[model samples]
Target: IDGFGGLRSKTKVITGVSLPASIESIKARLPVWNFDGSSTGQAPGEDSEVILKPQAVFRDPFRGGSNVLVMADCYTPGGEAIPTNTRAGAAALFAQKPEEESASGPRRPSHRAPRRSST
Candidate 1:
């Protein structure tokens, strides 16, 4: 104890780094775009979010996918997790992709192969 009821010396350590690629990109882009968090220019209900961008924060940039990061206000009043909304939104977005259909039909043989005069 030094003087005013406080500890004198202490040591701190870093365990891990868990920043996502998307978030890192956002932070990097901040200077280029000059995005200010002013109310007039920002998106609706953006101020209510804790972690504004989840995918951006957790994604790996080197892998190279999902250029845009989506942030959803998915929290409940009771602090309970709501996964249904997020899952549905992702599903809807995924459905937009076009699927290829096969043009070939099933083949059926007219006769059996060379059964030597069984009759």
Candidate 2:
């Protein structure tokens, strides 16, 4: 969210990168990129700059094979996580329930309890 709490997002494609690397490696190779926040309603029009910090990586289910989907949080230039950085909250939530965490992070159980049949 921006100073106004409006949700915003953008799609960025990165190419010319080597493949078959671990997600952590990809994250390490990534850099903090910036964008015009005003264009995304994330900052004032005059000095609107929002910083993106990569936090996690997932296999790009859409494109398939060695592709990735990077998860990131927004932050100010000075390093303060913006309200849009909801992963911080999720981390805290998982901290309180470690067993709830899975390889893909916290998720609801896939199993369902059996219902009793009415006679």
Candidate 3:
């Protein structure tokens, strides 16, 4: 928010405004968050910077064809967003990278004999 716009002392005092025109404009300013939890993978001394990945894009019905709705998922250097309940035995499933297949190569199909009909 530094280079984008100068900071004002008061939140109510909006002497100026700069709005993003397109989706790319908005995307450039995304991944913005307040780092507080430990799941963000940020060290105590490191700067807080949240990361967001774009998932899908849809036309904004309310805003007509000029605007769009961007669906994205928040991710930290460690992983996706953490669940509200951080207790054991909880059924929370976080997003993770897909597993790699075996290095041996792809599996082959099995051969089977054809059956004859008893007319």
Candidate 4:
């Protein structure tokens, strides 16, 4: 995961206003279990932070059964998009020095196949 092309930052928050009363209550009772940076200016009660809880809907499309979705806070800053889940692709492109020592060449493709002629 080192030497990613660029740094990517992203933040995901689940607020109470987006969920039902049940979720809000749950968050009120157990705010520690909720994601951080979710403070939505809601008043802080004696024991509750008046925060919103994520929606608690369970619907599975692949399994065709009830499922629970747990929300998480993901922060990715300047993250480079690397397809095929290749870690090496995320790193900086390798350049080769050519006739000009001051300049370098572009990264060559990792995989190349011989050309084929169509009949």
Candidate 5:
């Protein structure tokens, strides 16, 4: 997956204090790319075509306690340098929140068990 073996700056940890809108924005920017091989996403198509396709985002212990982890799949043009791509992409999309909302927090699952009828 993307950011599998990248640097600390690459992967990010969204604690249980992040906002839903922020999460959505980050999710929407999935499949992040580091074409210039830099932590800050910039200068596209300069060096390598490393892409990070976010597979899923869930609440887990990525940094410490229950937090949000942006899992992704790295890809390259030759399909032979997945590790490289992963590392690059990871450095690009770390802990980047949405532009508008500044509030933060985690969201609990909405699913609930069915109730049984009384006899």
Candidate 6:
């Protein structure tokens, strides 16, 4: 998800190293990447380069094997978390709270409350 807790995505082509490599090693070898955030409503066109840092890895169920999906945190070129970097804040809160105590999910305003079913 993008920093704003919205579901936005961009795919990066993997090269050189393949699976069997730890996520940390892969992240260590990769340089911080930037993308134009204007399209995502994250930044203005003139200064839209948002930097990404890999934070976690998930198995790529689509590709399977050692292939993985990366979870990243976004930041400005100045090294500050983007204003919408809710992941960082969530991480901090998660760190302080036990796993079971934490509630997580995208909270879209357009989603309606759960409906009660009649027996």
- How high is the CA lDDT of each candidate model? 0.33, 0.72, 0.39, 0.31, 0.49, 0.75
Q: Give the TM-scores of the predictions, in the order they appear.
A: 0.18, 0.65, 0.30, 0.17, 0.32, 0.66
Cα lDDT tens digits for candidate 3, 62-102 = 86644555554444456645232121112132123236432
**Index of the highest-TM-score prediction:** 6
**TM-score attained by model 2:** 0.65
lDDT of 2: 0.72
Highest lDDT against the true fold, candidate: 6
Clashes of each: 2, 0, 0, 12, 7, 0
Tens-digit lDDT string for candidate 5 (3-115):
33434335544344544545556567444643333433321345456655665676556554435677555556554445444444544444364354423223334567899
Models ranked on TM-score: 6, 2, 5, 3, 1, 4
lDDT of 5 at 75: 58
Runs in model 2 lying further than 4 Å from the true structure: 1-9, 89-110, 115-119
The true-versus-predicted C-alpha distance at residue 37 of model 3, in Å, is: 9.1
- lDDT, model 4: 0.31
Give the 10-residue window scoring lowest on summed lDDT in candidate 4.
Answer: 34-43
Q: Is candidate 1 or candidate 6 better by lDDT?
A: 6
User: Which scores better on lDDT, 3 or 5?
Assistant: 5
TM-score of 4: 0.17
Q: Which lDDT tens digits does candidate 6 get at residues 1-119?
A: 55355876667877776755455566666567788888887878899999988876667899887667777788889988888887788877878856545555543245588999988
Order of all candidates by lDDT, from best down to worst? 6, 2, 5, 3, 1, 4
Query: Which ten contiguous residues of candidate 5 have the minimum total lDDT?
Result: 35-44
Put down candidate 1 lDDT per residue, 1-119, tens digits, no spaces.
Answer: 21133322222222443345446555443211111222222223444222222222234355445433333323333333233234435545556753733232223335567768867
